[model samples]
Target: MTKEEAKKKWDLTRKMLEITDDEYNGVTQEDANLRFVKMKLQIAVYYMQLLDEHDSEYQVPWNKEQFKWALRKPVGDKKKQQAKEWCHQCRLMRDKTCTNWNYEEVKTA
Candidate 1:
């Protein structure tokens, strides 16, 4: 998902699930399976946000295997470069470094 889409997603998830950034920080590591499941749902929502924003036809597979595949896919060369620039700009606003280093921005949506 693009950065703006990602931000829009977390805004919704954070509100719906009462999830703060602090909570997300612990989810992926503290309790591996359940948190990962939660993350998958959040990520599905994130990608949906992307689809809405970009008018992309990409479809997300909701099964466990799909989540694994999504997690494995690379950001690609050009998008990776752009994402890094965006990430750096985002990092400047937060005191703590991102745990999800590849796709994080400050919770400022």
Candidate 2:
């Protein structure tokens, strides 16, 4: 099955099983299988949030530059250059050292 199909199946199972964050937190480290399942589900949830087609709320954790970098097509030299620039700008923004990182202006520049 495709990853998306598997994720949908897991989500349905989670809903049917009524798995809650509280339950995951209460589980001890000794229960490795439970912990692993919880971890994997949480990651899958985040991945879905990131890949969601409409109204993605997952962009909050990422800056504009990082989000743009993720959205950039991974093809051709032009896109590759834009991706590299976005990555550099994101790092600079995170470091609080970039004084001239205007999104619209930089995109045209």
How badly does each model clash, as a count of residue pairs? 0, 0
Per-candidate TM equals 0.30, 0.25
**2-91, model 2: which lDDT tens digit per residue?**
445545644753453344576556555434344444344344343443233222222223354643443333324443444345444434
lDDT digits (tens) for residues 32-94 of candidate 1: 433444444554454445444444443333344543433342424433343334334333322
The window of 10 residues in a row where model 1 has the poorest summed lDDT is 92-101
C-alpha root-mean-square deviation, each candidate: 12.7, 16.2
**Residue 6 lDDT in model 1?**
54
- Which pairs in model 2 have colliding backbones? none
Candidate with the greatest lDDT versus the true structure: 1
Best by TM-score: 1
